[model samples]
Target chain A: MVEIESMVPIAAVVDLVLGIATLSIISRSQGTSANNRIVGCILGWILVFLGLSYIMTSILEFRYGALADFSAVDRDKVGGTFAFTAKNLLLSSAYMLMVLLPFFFPFRLINREWDLWFLLAGVCVACAVFTAMHLMTNFEHFQVENFLFIPGYVVLISMYIRFIITEARDNDERLRKVSVVVGLVLIGIHGETMTYWLSQVLSINDLFFQRQSIQSGLSISAAAWGGINTRLTLGATAMLVLCAGEAWRSFKVGLSPFGVLTFIIFIIGFVAGLADLAVLDVVRSCYETQCEAFPVAYTIWYDFTSEALVYLYTPILFMFILLHYDIVDTKREENRWLIRIIVILMLLIVSSTILELIQSFLPIPDMISSAALAIVVGIFIGWEERIVKSLIDDSASIQETVPDFALPEIEHDFASPRLFNLVFGGVTAFILIVSLLFTGLGVLG
Target chain B: MSSDDTITSRSLLVTRESRVPTAVALLVTVVMMTVTMVDFVGDLRATDTFTSNTPDWNLTFDVQNYTMQAVETLQDDETRNLEFDMAEVIIPEGYSLGLIDVTITSEEEEGISVQCDSVAGDLIENGLTAQWNSPMSNLSGQDSSCQPIELSLQVYPDFDGRSITVSAVNEYQAMQHWLQDGWGQGVLSVDLELDVNSPLGFDPIGQDTDEEITVDVTVIMFKANISLVE
Candidate 1:
């Protein structure tokens, strides 16, 4: 069986391109409403953070091969390497942005002038604290920052349920738009975990971790293991809640595409849970006997669901939110061509990656697959205008849609895209410098 | 109603319009967070005290051998050779071929006047996936006085012994690394030559003219079994 290729490269390239494209759009929309501008900047920066993190991850994978294929000990053995350390730090930085994103987007919950400072400070403090803790503990406490996701999860989930309830109560289609945005944000953040919902609920995920620990010869501290379980529990709970929320909304106000997306994810989780059960022996092989290779089919299942969600679909989802919701001022005439280019470019790239993945498993001859790719490319090119127009035509900013629900703008002179770029840009440089220094001095690894 | 009381996103959770969903959200988040924090804290405490009960892994090696032997008759001044096709050696599941040994023997009874003719065995490394020139490998063994000459080669690198106890394994253990195909493979040849040193260096009768030679080859295969040290 062909091995599943690494998705870090795909995630890296997609996030970087989409992020830069988004920021460029935001930079040009200087006259937009302050709330939308801030939201766009935050989303853009989140993507950039994720992009840079994935880039570091790609570098690490290139240097030491896939982390999943490595035993835990070997994972740590390479963990001390420059790319590995940089990758984790960069990821933690991305997570910090993700954690703060909910408060800004869909609706700026923390709308005061100083709330902006709090966010900047949160990112800064999180960066310093996490960097110190990881180094002090030799990266053992890296996952500890998972606790930080709780606030974001709580805000997103709460906003989602609240808005959906209001939307149904008022029969206001505008409010449904808000709910959909919140749901998309929820899925974007917790999608991978959501796919493991069944396994997490059944605690089969714990067994898998146990097997990994035993095989890697690494005994994680209770704290670290707890961190892992915490994240899993959050994902599991979020999945259940999402499935419930989506089903209720669909029943109340005919199904939306977002509802269908949630159900599909729910189904994937159900199947994934069964698959995890089917391979219980393989997962427990290390604890009971010796470790065994997971069946190729099981691995392929993971590749399509969890791996694809994280590496491919999440960016697409974000792009949808950006364009569909008019987060980046997509209506402006000058910006139309660029948005169209990004939409088509992202679609093409994601399509090519999926085709490559299918070709890896299916017995399609190279010529046939190439032709299939050509067909996809042709179809996308033919429908490029329609796709871009569909995304841009009905776009309305959250500020414009649910004005009654919006909190009054607390600051007139709000932060600009430049300030965020400058701050996050500095954070990136700092991370790279620290990584280089620690790696050079051999303080890490 | 009050300009100063316009609820921030943080405060809107408990506001009149959203209190119910906010409470439910808080409750769900709280329950999961509490359960997780407890588990994490307990684990953290266990680790900080240096009393972590991380399970000990015990790897027991099940040692077994795969052997092939051929007996040949060599007349005086006869050079007889036997090629042992190592491919015939079947490795059981989870077992790896670790060491290969070739023993060449010549029969020299006390009454026989054929004073153990110079017997030599050469384990020619035709195409074997083994450490052919290992210091432990006696690939070329010669016994002038008819002692069973032995030729040894390690099938895989650093294959010390089949019956080993690996107290710990660090990632995709040597079990996966050491288990490879074509180990101790290829055609192993043992060359035997007999020169009867009769009482006067002459054999009137052909009694001392012919000798029976035994070429014995053994392949040691090993499998690993793991148990918790606790």
Candidate 2:
């Protein structure tokens, strides 16, 4: 019997390869501007850090049969290795970075506006301190680090939204639509984060989970059909369809073969993600009963389907960026055969997803479904490579133009020192009041 | 006409014909909004009367290495009741005891049967049995091969008694007088469980798996009064 836990390392290895490929493509591409290069590099590093963390966690979990913190485990049982400590540090750092990087995107780190830069720096420091506290603490429950993390997430997302609005304000009709679509996608990604924050502030986590009837109803509703990921997929699919429509409207032409292939793969992935959510609902309903008899296979199927969508998402985004930027040299007819191969490959992947979904309810050997899925994924990586290479080549020959949409140059106000002092004073006063309130409650209780 | 003029005319045509599509989109949006609102309202109604039951008070006792002894006052032929002062639990005022459960666990190699008899107050003979072999049952004979047994006793609040005394007898040797000495050497742990009901009988609203409330009945052994309210 294949242990579901063993698949963690395999998935981690795949993630690491994808991360490395993304970074290498970005670094080697001569067509990307310095700003795009910086953004791409940061995104690549985010994936790399996440992948490494997963690898470390999987290793430790496989050895110990559970993911235990360094302080929680017996060193003798784990061969006195420092793997747990390293895993904690890596994963915590990755989480902090993931929360912080969006604010720094489009090169906000070098902004001449001192106030914005100062705020960003302060947020970074807070994140670092909270991450350190999370690492050092042995008590895993009732953490105050959550206070900092949630606020940091909120601030970063707010900053990104502000950036998008500023971009849209100065852009043409087409670019504005693009910005709006991207904004919707970003909101979908962070919707769950905001919900968690609201739950924490209201102390409603228990109440929220206890509404089984509501959850069941939501499981069937279109708005929350597949839970949060369904919403995400909806936003992403909308973006892709809008982009395709825009391409058609502007160029008065049909999609290139590459575009068609990418679209097909994305739709298959979105459907598969939705199907996985339904499978999860089924598994959860029967988890303690029917699924208990075949725990490993059910768990592996759930993880595989879920992770497949996540893996597909990054490549889909890459394809979307290519389409939105009009980087594909469709006029070149040399790669027609390659496109045909890609189309065939994508069709196979779609068939595999359908097969896997059907097999999810069947009594067939899980290995057959797993092998089919793995083969397609292996082919997908190579296909992604060819597409990225073609886009890079096309982009190199493209000349820079005064874009119909241009970002507005931001000027920092030499804000009167007195106003700055007043603002700082108010912030300090608020912090003091909050601290006093907490201290008073502690003392009285 | 020139190509640029043709393109401009086409764009105008498309714009003029866009009204139907725009209205259709608007209609779809409204329908989606209505569905979401209806679902939201339904969920609110479902959870409106939902409330979790929280026990007003709970008392748990952990008795370790309790060695059973034959009553020396009685002759072996008369009765072989192996007795120990399992635990003495006190329920605070304003809260009445609604349930009492006892679990006896042992790790001895030999199998034994147990029965409980009330010395004072009322303990309803609600026969509820729970048996589970220890994970180490497959190990050597020296290893703990015993199973856990649970006894649930219902108590009435009308009894108005704050205290209760119960004695556990080894049924296996109680019937065989020849094994009285062997049964005396048996040691087991006991857990005394009590649930106190609310005065108004209003169940608490939600269950928090994170923070479980447990009251130590062993504190009663020191004659200390404890009341745990959740």
Candidate 3:
């Protein structure tokens, strides 16, 4: 019986590496314009916050022996671990960044002079409120923060639809750039839920949650359940909307690479929903009889689809959005080498992890897997230059691609890379210290 | 390339011609969100109840106690052996047999004579499925001068009055583990022995050579009840 390995630690390394690389690029972006630099910095810090959060999660998983044993009811499992508290708080902070991201990125929707201050204030107030709420209630309301994703979800989805429509209506290829960026942002935030689109549509995701609740002896509150439903609804709705929009565009205009990606995800959701139904007995085992383990086939299916999408591929998605959209300045000679290394590193890392995951379930020999990994590394190394060139060759900011749709440039000196570093760096420190104090004082697990 | 075509977030929603459509889209979105929430709440409540429609009340064990008494008598006898089939003893419903204890005594029949009797009781391990090796199961006891001799045999493993916490999917499931069956259903053998002594060198032959023996047997039984500590 091969158990699913914890990807929290691996995700931690990937996020931190990509996140630090992104921020480093943003900090040294002297030749980039203010708006581009600010947008790049925001993207960088989103990854950074997620990276730090994953690190805390990995620590907690190690200390608790496994991450599956999370519960709000079990005292030793819940309020007793410090890393648990810090992880949620940090994640909520990341979510704050996510909620504010779409307003500025691709194009600043609300271009007020005080927009930066609003973004800053939003993160601070939201993080503080969530941290306090979790501490007061012992994380019973952790999912409540999911509500914050609402504004961002609506923005991303609406923008995606708007651009796709405009692109098709006017036959402007440039509008696809705007649509693609918006699509990538949607994936970055709601990718996990989007994979459950079929399950959410069938309204069976709630059964899975009920199974988890019974298994962990957690009594999920109405508010928590509502939060989960809200996220799933958003994700499911987004997937449906995208599927429709992309199918229309593909039929009306012909299939593009982005359209193909959307269809693939659509197919995955359909299949995953069927798989989830196939294992309904295993899922209900907690209630029917003693809890039962899922079949290896089902577990492998999940490992490849949802888990891979989340832990391994999301950072790649973000990186793509960064470079392919010209959010990160890829043209500089100084940045080129670093970007090349990150690309190759991410490719090799993802390939090796996938091979290892395959080995966990399949009866593949270690030597064979190693050789496969080596081959993958060699291939990536050989194609590194072409991959980087292809990625950066047409990397143009949306303003340049769709200058007609782009907002007029605001020439004010927006906050620099240093200010973002300071504020977000302070947030990181606050999370660490609060987690430490809470854990030491036995206030929360 | 002109400012007229420059798109803000508002351009998608803010059109004199598109206002009604935008309102409809917003209305549909809000309605769908609300409907999704209602479905979630409904499913959550429905999933909470199992296919069996089990009662929310849980079944757990609360330690309870009861005892059954059996007695036998023999007149002018030196030794009396009694065989009791415990299966014949009708234990109450929802109760379990825990252990059995036996006592033997010789009635004072030496009227004005300097005579004494030694009595012993032995509870032999027979066809009973019980804790034969437990230190609490005393098989034999002896006493002098008609003092009561007591012996015991353990019928259940670790049976006590201590309450237990049971976690199960439902009341019916918990009941499956609590209601035990067919453990104390065998023959209980009690052998009572007495050694009689005559007056000081008077009737040395055979007169007053016997003593009356009495035996008392007790079967301890228990039933477990439940409390909802969840």
Candidate 4:
């Protein structure tokens, strides 16, 4: 029997490739406007940090068998293994980036000028405090520190909603529909987190238990349930459906072939990942009594396939952003050829996943399936290189232009600069001092 | 210019004054906050009970003693057995019994061991049996065994003003081969201890009574077994 531990390295390598591709694409495209640059750079770093975190986590899990059973108290008293500590540090950094990137992305988008030094400093201090807390105590023990990250993301989503609503109000009927759909998709993606935060504030277990009870009623195992609940899976699925609807509407109104192709790839990846999770959920739920009788290798394959699909959606989103922002405008002929290549690569990835799923049921070796996936990924990397080269070559001749994003002008009261600085500085310093005092007390105790 | 550009320019020209959406958002947020606050307050109130309504009392068992003789019959069967009252529990007037518990402890000497596999009482049908190996060995004075048994009583109206009498039996039988070999001899001393407790309590969600009272009773038992050679 093949151990699940051996699969981690392959997964890590795949994530590493994805991270490199994202960074490479963002770097090569070097947005024509300041706002685009800020958004692209922040998002690219977010991807890099998240990818590194996952790679580290996978390596730790591979070496330690599985760290799921270890408690925070166990990690603290024993000082954890070196692999575990490094993994925690990377994960903490990833979470810190996750919170920071969203705030900056929206701020840069809304304000043409990037002059939020004080806000950036506050965020930096908060992230530093969180990192320290996570290091001193394990993630499980630092619930307060984990929770502090939520408000930033919540504010980010709220800003996006406000932007969408404003755009919907001002735009034409077609654009309005698209804006509303995207707004709903954003809400759906962030709904679970909002519900969780509300439940925590209300001190109600029922809010959490309701989801558990529904899963239990369906007889879904915890692992399958977790896959369904994961933010990446849920968010990607919602976005894929919404984007497909938008694409259909765009087609009726005559959209570019490139837009249709992007949506098609997005839909295919989402469906493939969702189908994998659904099949696993059904099989595991139905055979709850005899789940162990099911083949372990197939389970691992499904897990990897679902995870890869979810991760693949990130790059696809980045591509959508690039296209939407008009940062990487391809010539019509080149765009058509690139679209064809993308469609083919997407099909290859989907087929590879389906084949893996089938091999789990049949007594077949995975060598061919693995090779097919690797070859497709290699082709994908080469295709990405071609696009990057094109984008770079095109960028040199194209002059930077003013961004077209509109901001609603509103009259509001304003505090004097000196007063604002004094108050903000005082509050931030007080918070920092209190945090340091508590941390020192904790260490001494 | 595109339709998007036209809409943007038009929107920019008009001084946007619509507040319906903003009002709606604020209203929703306020309602949600109010509901959460109410729930938290309700939880706080539920936990702040200064005194409990349930009645609490303890019943102790007194010590008692008995003797038994083991005699071989014509069939060559040697047996000895004795039964005695362990405790009597009475519920106070206008009060109901919420729970009843009986505890038993036994000890014996090196040559003989005492085991109580079952107990019988008025409140319980037949008796409760030890679900495990509950023999008490007195070979060492430091070793003794105690078991707590809960009487399964019907809920509500059935347990009102109820009185229960409890009893247990200790039996010793010599091996037929030992009797046939004429090896039965000497006296075996066994000590038994018992305690009964019943609390007359009012259900928070159920029927309430004005009177709250406590009753305590104690009982004990001692037994000796004699093995005589025929």
Candidate 5:
């Protein structure tokens, strides 16, 4: 019963609330700009709307359960079982967006100094597209939704990539960067899974549009994502090691008791997020029972991505706070060492970006996209303005006249030929080519 | 483009201001829509569940007769002592009742009578005939419309150990009346246990009242027209 209930959309309400609360907390922390706050508020509204839908759908599910066991039903009642299921899934996704938007609400892009209502208006357009997708999904007009929603989703992803690259980097720390990378990767995986699911639902009655080749590609892409998860986790483990250094650095003189608690919670959240992804994989498998091996695996990978993102909530929130407060500096001498570590991260990001592009054409796995994104963020931490250098430097300056630590001195002769970035970049590119060749057979064919 | 030029520790943090992506994303969205349209239009008439001209049948079975002996007590065990030495059963031909083979015996006689009946005519017109010439008999005969037979044996044995064997090779129609005693495949699997009346009065035997005679009848049928479907 608990499993079934958990599967239901009811928990989405709690997620929405938590998401909104996190934003509020970020806002109250005082460093966030007004533009950031507005973005957050809009996202919060979206979350609330999504949460309501989840709650409504959950209630509808309850009604369905009640009616199913009975021998009789109302004669006039229309739009039967499929309608209900579609409604739940559609509304739940809209609510999922609600739950998701606040976490990475593109606030910095909207500025008090500049009139960016056009951008805000763009947000409105994205929301409208999302809402349309939601409606089409609920009505089971899957192909139509895919035709519409994929573009909407792609647009959203591109905007987010730009947003993160521009606004988020300034104050990033290794830990926060790791969290963002992991979160975005998870998001990408979710998108891919959604795409696969949509494609299947759409292809139910159609054969001539049988993109068997695309299907084959998606399968391999999903598997590649699985391989990437192992890599990402390894990257995360490296980040955790770096975080340990951060903890040690802050432990003696600068650490607040609350900060330590938050850090611990963040670790817990990361672990929880990983577990959630595993669970989501199982859920995806359940739905993809009839699908071939590769597609099923890919679907599962996509599921893992979403679940991981959702579960990584606390850590992501805490890391954001830490970045905002200048507690963990990404560009600090210790943080600069992460460049060697995050080469794999960069590789993951680049590979994923390529895969994402290819998948747009041939339906490659989303996990790859996520891995690429994660790696990108992982690499980005070394240079991110908002998270690693700016905020941390500002905070460090407040405590003591800290030196400009943007560029760290290399202690070893090995630093002259920095291979970390190169290796990661090369590997990521190689993976992208491999994935493309496998999925986009036209490339290999 | 440079790895160091991008990324942030705060990048993991989803800002309250994180707005939805627009321009670049919208263009991608439009392209995806186009692809979807092309796919849809291309497969306009092809659906999953299409079918034609194949008879769908499922395998199943039918249950028939189920029965048990009505009364086992109505049985007789006194074996009749007959002196018949020669007996013959004749089955008509052209009416195809298949093989009509039979055997006859007498308890008192050292050599029992046996014979094979091979007659030719329509069974409905000529009927089945069994003839016997016995050297020893107290009195004699019985006859039926389907099979005309006149032969009888008298007096029960003292110990009641006397045995009589009747054998025949017959087709389904020849044994139709007897088969009616038990019908259908499942029900006919077990042999019928019936009471056979003892021949009249040879009294005053010892109280070894275990007077029961069992005769096993094995009929090998050659042909049966079984109409399975209606």
Candidate 6:
């Protein structure tokens, strides 16, 4: 059982890589807009950050030395050690943000279909509910609370698969459908990572069992890798796919001369990273005795010039580009406020990314997951219709650029969201306030 | 539809939804009351099995020194027979082990030594009876009768904690058969009723009968021997 369980994270890593490649191929074949492609890129880097975070934190610290401030005591702690005390808390919060960030796409974008939105909402809710169970599990009588998370796995997996099968059909905009499918795969893998997190918490005592103790460490590493790697890989691939597709489509439609070159550069950079990862695996395995060699090679080839390595500056670079794009395009100005909101939401996404980086190994509370869900709901209540219509319009633009293609017919038929937005905003604000009271007042969180 | 009419309809719908909790509460109350009544009826017919009105019969233990040693050893061995001195055994009711301790001072010159040894378990021919051998005769002076002795058996039962009772007992009638014709004739009979209750300090014979005897038998102590019911 120990040896088998030790292979779980390896399997998860393989699945994550496959899932990312699938997204890349699907996006390349189907095509998507520039914005969705950008979101996909952000998500891809986030996953890589998650995977690396898991690896770094897994390096056990066994050193104990005299402290300058307290000479009598040694500070080093044994076993699975973290660079920072709050690493798990941060990673958990990041995974939660990933689970929720999709709900913010404006109404025009989501107008293509409601199932995708519902599935995303359902996954967010499941994440939040599981998070609540995780928090409640801190109670001494943890059985019932821990048991609640099992059902969440079923719900999330089923929802993701449902979203995948339904969106796989060749009907509407293939790029959007591919984005949704990739998103589902990422979500599915992330959800599985959550199952592993819950298993760790529930099986902590079981570690003493001969079979479990040996596998526990490896299982922890694998789960963490599965979680963060899938997010980063799939997230980055989707972004590159959507962005390259956008630039290529624009070029095909006679938009720009340099669009094809930009598209090729993005694809080559992505493929190069994939190749480097494969090479890194071989070298790291062979030089297992020389610990510093892999890190040195990784820093040079994989970490330094990696396409998704820009995620280190993701929070800043993505916003700068978005704001810059808004200036160059007039229609982007009409949606400039929405774009800024996206930037803020992306900032929150980055927070989850940072959290995920730390979460690579440990867990944070479910409250953070809840906050992310509230943000998602607020996004949906605020912008689903606009996002859907924009995607649909972008799709229609492929066939013709006539006046009738200006907007879809049901834009007017969709219910006015003023009431919904107000309610959603009110509820979100209330929840935020309550969370603040709980955490800040030292009552509960 | 007019704005006022729409507002009125919305208010009515709100009122209807609000009544749901109240309806649920009422249903819960009715169900709870019915459950209580059913439980109350069920408890009324439950039977009482642990109490009874009949008095209990008890057997007390007392032995001479030699018998006490043998019985104490037999207590540990479940299959061993507890040997006892049959001549020394004294049952407290009408039955006794052997001839009662009797003294007869003859007022004649000639003295006859009469001994009876027929009080053995194997000599009993029927329930509660023992055939006897004695130098005596019937009222017609036939050879089938034996000389009878006017012997009185004193019975003392140990009752501790009011644990023993002899209900519907006739101690006088049980003792009056000592002067039957075959037993003794032309002998002055002085019936001495003995009542000995050591623990309770209540003597039924001493309270009922006014007969006085020259010798007195006092019960010195009473102790209980308790065992598990099985």
Q: What is the TM-score of chain B alone in each candidate?
A: 0.74, 0.22, 0.61, 0.22, 0.16, 0.21
The stretch of ten residues in a row with the least summed lDDT in candidate 3 chain B is B57-66
Instruction: Supply DockQ values for each candidate.
Output: 0.18, 0.03, 0.23, 0.02, 0.05, 0.00
lDDT per residue as tens, model 5, A180-273: 3323333322322322222322322122122221222111122222222222222232233223433543553345443364355345435434
- TM-score-better candidate, 2 vs 6: 2
Better of 4 and 5 by TM-score: 4
**After superposition, candidate 4 runs with Cα above 4 Å error:** A1-15, A25-32, A65-89, A100-107, A110-123, A135-312, A319-403, A406-445, B1-230
Q: Cα deviation of B198 in candidate 6 (Å)?
A: 99
How do all the candidates rank in terms of DockQ, highest first? 3, 1, 5, 2, 4, 6
lDDT of 5 by residue, B1-230 (tens): 12334323232222333333334334433444345444444433221111111122221212121112211121233323312111111212211121121222111111122111111111110111211122332122221111222222211111111222222212222223222211111111111122222223222442222212222111112222322121
True-structure Cα RMSD, model 4: 18.6
Best DockQ among the predictions, by candidate number: 3
lDDT of 1 by residue, A1-445 (tens): 2346877788899999999999999989977777777777778878888898888777766766545632122454475777777777888888888888888887788666788888888998899888888877778766777777888888877777777776777678887888788888988888888898888766567666666555452436665676677777778788887788889888888888888988999999999999999999887666545678998878777877898898899999999999988888887899999998888888888888888788778877878878998999899999998988888898888878867667887654647888888888888888888888888888876
Q: What are the fnat scores of the candidates, in the order listed?
A: 0.25, 0.01, 0.34, 0.00, 0.08, 0.00
Cα lDDT for residue A175, candidate 1: 76
Worst 10 residues of 3 chain A by lDDT: A66-75
User: What lDDT tens digits, residue by residue, belong to model 4 across residues B36-98?
Assistant: 445434432322220111122222222232222221111111122223222222333322222
Q: List the residue pairs that clash in candidate 1.
A: A72-A216, A80-A445, A222-B43
Better of 1 and 2 by lDDT: 1
What docking class should model 3 receive?
incorrect
Tens digits of lDDT, candidate 2, A1-445: 2222333454355445544554555434554443444344444444555566566557667767553211123223432234444444444444444444434332233334553445434534654564444333321211232222333333333332332333333432232333332333333233222212222222222223223322221122222321322222223323333334334433543344433533444444445444434444343332111211224443454344434444333334433343233233223344334433433443454456455545655655888778877777677666765754464444421113223222332444332223323433343343334334433444211
Ranking by lDDT: 1, 3, 4, 2, 5, 6
Best by lDDT: 1
How does the DockQ of candidate 2 come out?
A: 0.03
The number of clashing residue pairs in each candidate reads 3, 0, 6, 11, 43, 38
- In candidate 3, stretches whose alpha carbon ends up further than 4 angstroms from where it belongs are A1-3, A69-75, A78-80, A217-219, A285-290, B1-6, B12-32, B39-169, B179-230
Model 6 residue B151 lDDT score = 33
Candidate 3 lDDT for residue A439? 83
